[model samples]
Target: MTLLGDLLADLDAEAAELRSVVAGLDADTWATPTPAPGWSIATQVAHLAWTDERAALAAAARTPAGREAWDAEVARALTDPASYVDDGAHELARLDPTELLAHWDAARAALGEALCAHPSSERMPWYGPPMTPASMATARLMETWAHGLDVHDALGARPAPTDRIRHVAHLGVRTRDHAFTVRGETPPAEPFRVQLEGPSGAMWTWGPADAAQRVSGPAYDFCLLSTQRAHRDDTALVATGPDAQRWLEIAQAFAGPPGPGREPAGCADARSPHG
Candidate 1:
């Protein structure tokens, strides 16, 4: 399977997993706060669904002019930052549990179809920059994993870690420079090595081990902390170099204003099925 295809499969699986988790949730559960400070579990699902629709729209636009139009639509959606999550939450809340799953399944299928139709190398306009269809698909996977972690935290359910999360992890590592620049920090000149603890508790390294700067740690922790799925303090990632550590300090894979990005206290003993 192509890289994009593999990513789409992961996306489909994660979305379905989320739907399954939320399927039988009572209204009260939907309103329960996720690990994210202000957002509820309902808000997380809504954000995922809304972003999928937007990504599909973006992928469908073939021509440069068409891509431009799609970008304009995304810009419009951001004017009321919370509207995307709010609309999704309202829609999900109105549906019976079964209907909600049906909607989620259909939405994911449509998204997969949109991704399958485009070649990964086909460039498309993104909210911040131009990216290939493949890159956009990875973005979707990253969001799914990030938000999925939030749901898992809220339910006190520990999800099994998967190396499949590597794609998102790589995205986070690659975006280190951008993350730093977004925070008004000087971009590093030297390449940084990244090591992450995988699902099986094995180390997965990215970049180079002996590079001037290095990021090394358990994969799950790095993934969680990078995506803001969990607090950095919740994990045991060690960045030997100051630049590498600083990058983790404000690392974010998603595009938007800077967030709290700090490691919350008591993350080690926080609720988790795996623990």
Candidate 2:
């Protein structure tokens, strides 16, 4: 399969896994607060629904008006950028739990179809830089997996790691420069080697094999760090050079503004091992 095909398949599988977790939840469980500050289980799914719908619309909009509409929507989102996601979730929360699930199911299906049908080379407008179909699909998979973590944590369940995380890990590695640029820092001219232990016990690598700088660890921890779901100090990932360390400190796999990463596992200072 092509890159786009692989990404699309991964997106669908991730979404299905998330849906299975939520499918059996009761109303009370749906309202349970997740690891994400101020977001409930329902809110997480709602946000995914909203994003998928927007992605589908963006892909379908080829005209000037259509593009302008998306731009306007993004501008509105930027107005209260911090609360933008929560606000959208609140709107969707007005619906019944089952209704929200149905909406997400439909939106996710539409997004998968729209993305598969789109030209792989044409860029689709997003809140950040425009993304090609492959990038968009990979982004969706990343989001799905990230939010899936929220849902699982809320339910006190630990989902098993899968090889699918290779996609997210790859994105994390590729976004090394974006992570720096977002923070107004200059990225290193020399690439850093990333050596991760994949789910199936395979080594996944990027950059030079014998580079001076290197990041080495379990792929799962790297994904969490890249997505800001886990603090750097909390993870087992090791950085061998200045650039590699800085990358771990501010790495981000998702688009848009830099995220306020999670507080250190249980400490006031993120740098402190313990509070």
> Could you tell me which residue pairs clash in candidate 1?
158-273, 196-218, 196-219, 197-218, 197-219
Q: Give each model's whole-structure lDDT.
A: 0.73, 0.85
Minimum summed lDDT over a 10-residue window in model 1 is located at 266-275
lDDT of 1 by residue, 1-275 (tens): 97887888887787777778888888888778776655677767766766677777777788677677796887776887655545655666456556655666676777788778877777766566877877888888888888787887789887788887888888888788778887888889988888777777766777766797887777777777767656666678887778887887888887765666544765443421110
With candidate 1 superimposed using the best TM-score fit, by how many Å does residue 99's alpha carbon deviate from the native?
3.8
| TM-score against native, each model | 0.85, 0.91
**Which segments of candidate 1 are over 4 A away from where they belong?**
63-72, 78-97, 201-203, 267-275
Which parts of model 2 are misplaced by more than 4 Å?
A: 63-72, 75-82, 268-275
Error of 1 at 3 (Å): 0.9
The count of residue-pair clashes in candidate 1 stands at: 5
Question: Which numbered prediction scores highest in TM-score against the true structure?
Answer: 2
